[model samples]
Target: MRNVVLGVANTVAAIGFVLFASIVWSAALPLAIGLFLGSLLGPRIVRRAPQTALRRGIALAGLGLAVYLAVEAYG
Candidate 1:
């Protein structure tokens, strides 16, 4: 739940930056669409996912994201 809020906040901020900065939409549109679709389907997925697996998956993804951000910021 908290991660969902953080993800949403990051998404909104990214969208704002993209819109205000006038970045190349063509370069990012596909990735954005895939992410949006994946998130949109999460409810259906959750219905099928086992509780423990879901928690592990989310934790793994969060760790991956943290590492990616750390490298992007300080690597």
Candidate 2:
């Protein structure tokens, strides 16, 4: 029962992430880069740490930098 509940929760979260990414994808390039970098850096920044605030900040910074670079390179 517990496993089933957890699985459902995970599925819901995954769907939400996909939907959010799809919305960002509509912006074309910059947002796609931001999302990609966020997925890559966000985990490392937040891993095995109890500091939620710092993790969020680092993830946001990474996302911003990725978007900026993408726009500068392609735009």
Candidate 3:
């Protein structure tokens, strides 16, 4: 989980840097603030959550999304 988070963070940082000139500050500023706040608080919240339960919930959600997409595509 830690590796996955780090991988995505690094990739997003690179992409944002490359597109720095094209980003609309008006639209991105509010979102950037929200994300900054979430980054500060999310780890504290996750530390208190049950690991097994979190894993189960995530697996179920992935499975549900896969099933939904499959049905939508084949129906």
Candidate 4:
């Protein structure tokens, strides 16, 4: 299944990221703090948002990122 393949890919990517992070010791603390804060506050924020609003927000974010990348690549 596509989900199984994606899950395996994500797991492998996560392991690779951990290995890369271990080599970049200085980033560990900041990444840890960010992970902690996101874990703590992310769900709470999402829970309060309406589903439609959340969907639009995600779409807008993706669109913005695509535009930024396009500009960076070609402008």
Q: Which candidate's lDDT is highest?
A: 1
The segments of candidate 3 whose C-alpha lies over 4 angstroms from its true place after superposition are 1-41
Per-candidate TM-scores read 0.57, 0.34, 0.47, 0.59
What Cα-based lDDT does every candidate model obtain? 0.92, 0.84, 0.89, 0.91
TM-score of 3: 0.47
Off by over 4 Å in 2: 1-50
Ranking by TM-score: 4, 1, 3, 2
What does candidate 1's lDDT look like per residue over 13-67, in tens digits?
9989977887777878898898899889988999999999999999999999999
Instruction: Report the lDDT tens digits of candidate 2 across residue range 1-75.
Output: 999999899999878987776555556578769989998997896775678787787799999999999999999
Error of 1 at 56 (Å): 0.8
Model 3 clash number: 0
Pairs that clash in candidate 1? none
Best model per TM-score? 4
Sorting all predicted structures by lDDT, with the top scorer first, yields: 1, 4, 3, 2
User: Total clashing residue pairs per candidate?
Assistant: 0, 0, 0, 0
